[model samples]
Every structure is written in C-alpha cells, then in structure tokens.
Target: MFFRSSKINEFRLWGLLFTLAGMGLMILGTSGIVFWGQAGKIFAGIFMVIGMIAMLISVGVYFWAGMMSTSATMLTCPECSRQTKMLGKTDRCMYCKTILTLDPGQATQHPADTTQT
Candidate 1:
C-alpha cells in the first residue's frame, strides 16, 4: 500500500540542513583565521574539510532523489480515484490512504511485500 511521502521529504530536508551546516562551518573556519592565528587556521582547515565532505554527500543524495522522483510513474488511485506518483514496485496514493501495488503477483505471492501489497 501507500507509504508516507514524509520519509522521502524528511531525507531531503535533512540533506538540505547538512548542506547548509557544512557551508556555515566552512565560512566560520575561514573567517577565524584573521583573529585566531595558527590554531584558528588549523581549526578552520579541519572545519572546511568536514564541511565540504558533508555538502558533497548531501548533493549526491539530493541528485539521487531527483532521479528517483523523475523515474516514478504517475497513476490514479483506484481507491480514491486521485492521481499520485508511484515509486519503486509499490507506493501509496498521495491523496488517498489506500495501499497501491504495481505488481499483482507480489500481492498474491509475498503478501508481505508491503510495497506492492
């Protein structure tokens, strides 16, 4: 059946937060050098590296989500007759609470493949 869009949205939100946090850390690290001397410079360098890595990972995840979103197929919910996109083998209608499945065999065979059941 349908799963909550909140999970994917949450991941995207967290990725954004990480990206912003990384940028802020990088800036703070660079700015510290003017007043803090060698120690500040070293700390700033460390922050910069960590921040860059975090931002890179976030960017990669965002890109992946984008690709998945694009590949998701749009369908009408039989339960509510509302339209929504299906990701993977199963997904829920955004407007309806009905559990939708893309694969009929999954519902009959696995029964527990919630994605398709």
Candidate 2:
C-alpha cells in the first residue's frame, strides 16, 4: 500500500515522473533567457535537449508498459473485489494491496515472511 502498486501502475508512475521532469527542465531552459539575458541561450539549448531526451525515454517506458500490460494476467482481487493486473507469478492487489499469486507455493508467502529472514 505504502510503496506497492501494480506493475502497470508502477510503469505509469515512472512515466509520469519522467514527463514532469522533462517539462520542468524545458521550463527551466526557457526561463534562463530572463535570468541571464543572451548568455542563457546556450544553457537553455542544453537543458532543452536533455529534457527532450528524458521525454523520449518516458515515451519508451510508457510504450513498453503498454505492450507488457496487454499480455499480463488479469484477476479479480479477493480483498478488494476489483479486477487487477498481475505480472510474473506474484503481485499485490492494486487497490487493497493484498498479496496475490497464481502459484500455490508462492501464495503462502507474505510480506511478513520476508521480514523474518
């Protein structure tokens, strides 16, 4: 719940962060002209280029997430009674954060189990 989310959501979160960061960088680049007059253009260009790269990376991440999501297992969360997507053999409920798994062996393992060892 605190730091857990569906794989798809996690990817989306990263994409959102990248997008925000890129936008912020671009804004900062534009603002350089106001702060440094003519010399700011060089800094502005460099920042803008880096920002574009970040945005491109974000797009790639989003695309990868979308492709992965299409093949991910969809299940009804017992705890939340909501449909959620799960990646790999185990994942937590996106809404309720209840541990979920398709394998019987993994199903018995919980967050507490990891903390003990």
RMSD of each: 7.0, 6.8
TM-score of 2: 0.87
Instruction: Give lDDT tens digits, candidate 1, residues 56-89.
Output: 9899878887777777788888877877777777
lDDT of 2 by residue, 3-102 (tens): 5877778888889999999999999999998899999999899999999999999999999999999999999998889999899988888788888899
- The CA lDDT of each predicted structure is 0.75, 0.88
Model 2, global lDDT: 0.88
Model 2 bad stretches (over 4 Å): 109-117
TM-scores across all candidates?
0.62, 0.87
- After superposition, the stretches of candidate 1 with alpha carbons farther than 4 Å from their true spots are 1-3, 6-8, 31-35, 77-82, 92-99, 103-117
